[model samples]
Target: MTRDGAGLRVGDRPYRVFGCNTYYLMAWAADPNLRRHVDEVLDTAVQFGLNTVRTWAFNDGEDQWNALQPRPGEHDERVLEALDYVVWQAGRRGLRLILALVNHWDDYGGRRRYAAWSSTAKRADDFYRDAACRRCYRHHARTLVERTNSYTGRVYRDDPTILAWELGNEPRCARDPSGLTLQYWLEEMSAHLKELDPNHLVGTGLEGFWGKWREGRYNPPRWLGGQGSDFLWNHQPDTIDLMSFHVYPDHWHMDEKATMRWIREHLDAAAELGKPAVMGEFGKRGPRALRERCFRKWLDATTSAATDTEHPAAAGALFWALYHDDYPDYDRFGVYRRHESTVDLLRSYTAR
Candidate 1:
């Protein structure tokens, strides 16, 4: 395990991280094609030195509206089935999977209106409000967590393949969740996870852009502090034992010097809280040359302590992907072609 200066200890590490941002779980529709690809991806990841994986547990609709009573947070069989296989596969290959419980897509796809939390207060208004959502939470949230806490909804909770339980993906998305509603939901969800999955750590997948206009602190944008100063930092979401961050080129592109400098700025921000934060999702999706250039630049800068302008805050780094995209759109972002590549320069630094 490696613990960067972030003060958060990454279990089972040699200081640097080697992982892949994956979507195999998303495509699993209880089909053989999906299962085959899942094994292929995991095997490839292991051979390429990948030690960790950041994968999602369920989609918004994995267990959506039930025509029946729908009591509390009952998940459909699809979620349980998919997770069982995912955990089993990861465990077999020695890969740790960090499962994100909720995400913004489809029903909760950061859309203007998507109600995952409902209320049953004396008044409709009260029930519709966040307070009401909080009130009815335990019944719904606990059911969802309890089902997944076990190896199978059909079995018991004793899987050693899980790395952490994340409350949601980028709960800070203003487009989908209102600040207050999302914050309250996150607090409730995090607390719910702690009770359900105490065996593993918990966190939220957050994107790093500390000095943004959305926050109330720093008009001129000097620095930040405390919980209320920023997005993820603003709310001390429950069950968050570790932190994850995402980064990409700006609107267009940034050179090596600019990219490394910006990384430093964010690392400095995370360092103050003295919490371990992983660069969970980061990479340039363009021509192969551009991608290679960026990775080489980042790797060179990170491997050498001199390039880090601030404290060594980031614990591990995982590229955006490791699979081959069949379509033209996917090719631009995929780090490998149909056959995949061991030349994934980022994987070279997993031993860090």
Candidate 2:
């Protein structure tokens, strides 16, 4: 994919993403007994007309489930093969992927694990500043990018199936509210990834937080320059091809109006930067009726903005997650096959 001003293009045609985050693909594919589940989820994506799928490509530490890197600089070949399977299968189905290299959270032993591996680190955020932790991250990035998919026999960097390489999942450095720490980390990491694979796009998996440099009324009160992510400054790196931000109104204490405003603000910001923007993740949790209503509202807002002639439209929007019957609705944000109404809503939007 290539960036065309504020839009994205595949060859000469414009490409707008209609997709969902399915973070379990690699883990599911890794287990021989659970490989079928990965197929089931991807099949559902095709059924819904989604052209893209974003999932985790990183699992760290020895104790974590489906740990790809059991220890610093060490990988389990079996799990890596499973990830290869995911790339092959998704490519066969004509779905592009955004594979995140790490995470800011501890769910899959993210920065916390990296920090633990660093002798100079005292906190998770230290992973950004510590040389040892940064080295570990670079090693992982190289391993994955240079890998030749066992199933496809194509090096990951040469594979067109992978849409982009995300820097990390909602990367933040709360220890430095000025946002310079995370911004500098993103610049260094994105440049490194590009140096390894100039064929694909790189993104900062930020949650659209404003930094002290650009804080104002548009920011949520609780996030007024405190999350260590400046959506604007972070994307300034030339190697950063796409701008990404996630939305979770319920968790952020935002109502419907505030949520729409947040979306617009990010879209407008990306337009100003002359790069394509994607709502990489968004979701609502509650009664079935409320969830469906909110989903439709947000989808309409994003779609409408895409068609506007005055400014650049968002490249795409992906909901929080897509899950199958085999998995539990652990987050309450899961969109399952049984949710007929929600499925129809998403399907209809994708058709547009």
What TM-score, to 2 decimals, does candidate 2 have?
0.97
Q: What is the TM-score of each candidate against the true structure?
A: 0.73, 0.97
| Model 1 C-alpha lDDT versus the unseen true structure | 0.54
Off by over 4 Å in 2: 215-217
Model 1 misplacement above 4 A = 1-16, 62-72, 105-145, 148-158, 173-185, 211-232, 235-238, 250-257, 300-312, 324-331, 337-344
lDDT of 1 by residue, 1-352 (tens): 3233454344654334457777545445245556677777778778778878887654443343311112334445654565667777788898987776545444322111224434333322232234544444444435444554334333223455666666655544333223444455556667776777576666667654343445543212232221222444533554566666665764325555656776665555556665556677777765677777777766554455322445555556677777734323453556654433336554556545
Error in Å for residue 50 of model 1: 0.6
For every model shown, the clashing-pair count is 9, 0
Q: Which lDDT value does model 2 have at 55? A: 96
The local lDDT score (0 to 100) that residue 40 gets in candidate 1 is 74
Worst 10 residues of 2 by lDDT: 215-224
Per-residue lDDT of model 2, residues 246-266, tens digit only: 889878888889998998888
